[model samples]
Target: MRVLGVDPGLTRCGIGVVDGAPGKPLRMAGVGVVRTPADADIGERLVLIERGIEAWLDEHRPQFVAVERVFSQHNVRTVMGTAQASAVALLCASRRGLPVALHTPSEVKAAVTGSGRAEKAQVGAMVTRLLRLDAPPKPADAADALALAICHIWRGTASDRLRQAVAAQRLRTPKGTA
Candidate 1:
């Protein structure tokens, strides 16, 4: 499956496309960051981000989109910008009818590096190693976006299977108290 992972930020949102499945070698289709002027109006910045994400979606044609879940930060302004950018990403994928998944930083780290608390450098190194890239993606954000895609491709499929199995079991169970 091909997944477009988004690491959303107002000033610099990272976007990456990865193609692979569980137990297979993942390949990087593309990776880049979308930058918006810090002084730009919030509305304009969001529009810029939306347009950039749409372009990536159109170009990569990913079957699924994995976005980094926004976590609260001490700086409210930063958090708000991230949340806004994230919403734009979600909207883009929804409009295209692509399945969307939200993965937290810790979840992506754990999936990629076998530790929830892995450092950024570790994650970057692992991402480089996993995709067999000659060097790590720059600015950390690009590598982060790739990591999100890698995490979803590896874990999302298994999660989907588990959900299906549970649904199947529910269908077989009669209506009664457990």
Candidate 2:
């Protein structure tokens, strides 16, 4: 499956694309970071995110969008920014009629580095090795985004999908003990 992973922020949003299946190495399609000037108004920053996300979707045409979940924080300001960013990212996927999956930081870290406590550098190194790339993905945020994509690919719920498909098929059949 083709997946678009996003690490969202008010001033800088990172995005990455990859194709992979469960228990397989992810093939990196591309990685990019979108930046808005710190001095820009909040509205302008949000607009930038919306446009940048749309452009990425158009270019990648991913089958799924994987996003980091926003966690509650002690700092109100930090929480607000993260919440807003997450909302916009989800909106972007919904607008495109794409399926979205969200994972926690711990889940992504563990998936990328085999330990939830793995440092950013460790995660980056693992991402490079797992993808068999010449170099590590640039900008820590972009690396994190790529990691998210890899995590989703590795941990997707194929069995759940199968169950749902089976239920739909049963519904289509006539009432009988087939």
Candidate 3:
């Protein structure tokens, strides 16, 4: 399965693509960050993000999109921008009819590293080792994007299967049944 992971932010949104199956080795298809000037109007920044996300979708044609779920932060402005960028990613995936999974930061950290509290450097090191890259991807965000993709590949697949199974069982049961 090919998965595109998005770490959404106004100033520097990270994007990464990975291809792998549940039990197979994962490969990095692409990784990059989308930058929009902080001084740029919010609308303009969103437009830039939309274009960047669309380009990635066209290029990777991922079967699934894994986006970082926006979490509450003390900085309201920062959270707002992140939520906006995340919406753009969700819209892009929806338009393409792709399955979208939202993973929390802690979930991503736990998947890539052993601990949910793993630091950035630890995540970066793990990402490098997992992808067999010569060095960690630059600008932390890029590595984070890759980590999100890797996490989905490792964790999301199982959840997807469970959901499908439940749906199938529901179909097998009578409409009035519990």
Question: What's the TM-score of each model vs. the native?
Answer: 0.89, 0.86, 0.89
Worst 10 residues of 1 by lDDT: 162-171
Of candidate 2, the 10-residue stretch with the lowest lDDT total is: 159-168
lDDT of each: 0.90, 0.84, 0.90
lDDT-superior candidate, 2 or 3? 3
lDDT tens digits by residue: candidate 3, 1-178: 8889999999999999999987788899999999999999999999999999999999988888899999976499899999999999988876555778999999999999989999999999999999999999989999999999999999988677554455446555555632
- Measured over all alpha carbons after superposition, the RMSD of each candidate to the real structure, in angstroms, is 7.1, 6.8, 6.0
If the candidates were sorted by their lDDT against the true structure, best first, what order would they fall in? 1, 3, 2
Clashing pairs in 2: none
State residue 111's C-alpha deviation in candidate 1, in Å: 0.6
Q: Which stretches of candidate 3 lie over 4 Å from their true place?
A: 159-178
Please give the clash total of every predicted structure, in order: 0, 0, 0
